[model samples]
Target: MSQTILITGGAGFIGSNFIPYFMTAHPDYKIVNLDKLTYAGNLDNLKEVENNPNYTFVKGDICDETLVNALFDKYDFTGVIHFAAESHVDNSITGPRPFINTNLLGTFNLLEAARTHWFDAPNTP
Candidate 1:
């Protein structure tokens, strides 16, 4: 059976590169890309997989728990590859809130969603 995977920050440089390669390697897997399209992310970078039937692009923030939870429920994602972050060092120093929110809280939201969807109980393997 094919699995659906959530790929965060997929329009960014590294995630964009990884998605196409991963798709080629795992053709049966469906990829849902969630990206906020921040300055570091570009949709054009992901054009290679834009037409692929198994590929989907969703423009949104990872910090939004409602959206993240909705996606988990809708897609029944089997896995998540997280790459979203506020990565500019200069910007992070000048304005740290976005970085903390996205890098820390955003990651927490994804993890929480995954845990809720994938596990039957807390700390159960």
Candidate 2:
């Protein structure tokens, strides 16, 4: 059976490097890359696996709950590899809201979507 995985920030440095390796390592797994294409993320970084049948890229923000939930419903993701964040210390110091929104709320959205999708009764167990 093939597993579908949601990879947030796959256009970013670490994620862009990791996706290709993960795809090569797990051929049976499908990857759905969701990235907002922020300053830290670049599409050229993911050119390697862009054409792969098992790879998909979505240009969007992880902070959008509606989009995230819709993705969970549409893809029925079996797993998630979250890498999205605002990591520049200088930028954070200049403007912390983006960092907080992406790092905290974005993570929360992904976790909540996962929990709702994966559990029959999220509050149970």
Candidate 3:
């Protein structure tokens, strides 16, 4: 059976690099990349796996709970690799609100969705 994995921020530096590497290493796993396409997130970084059969790209914000839930329902992903964040220290110092919104709140939403869909429900015997 093939495994479906959700990779958030796949357009960012670390995620963009990891996606191709992970896909290459795990050919049986399909990767669903969700990126907001922020200034730091660029599709050009993911050119290598753009046409890969096991890869998919979604452009959206992690803060959007509706979209996130919809994706979870659609993919039924077996795993999630969350890399979305506001990582620039300078920017964080200059304007901290976005950092809080994206880093903390964004992570919370993903975790909440994962916990609800993956763990909270009763087990099927």
Q: How high is the CA lDDT of each candidate model?
A: 0.94, 0.92, 0.91
- Model 1 C-alpha lDDT per residue in residues 29-111, reported as the tens digit of each score: 99999999999899998888999999999999999999999999899898999999998878887899998999999999999
Any runs in candidate 2 off by more than 4 Å, and if so which? 121-125
Tens-digit lDDT track for model 3 on 29-106? 999999999889999989999999989999998999999888988988889999999889798888999899999999
TM-scores for all candidates? 0.94, 0.93, 0.94
At residue 63, what lDDT does model 1 achieve?
98
Better lDDT candidate (1, 2):
1
lDDT assessment of candidate 2: 0.92
Number of the predicted model whose lDDT against the real structure is largest: 1
Q: Kindly provide the TM-score of model 2 when superposed on the true structure, using C-alpha atoms.
A: 0.93
Cα displacement (Å) at residue 28, model 3: 1.0
TM-score of 3: 0.94
lDDT of 2 at 36: 96
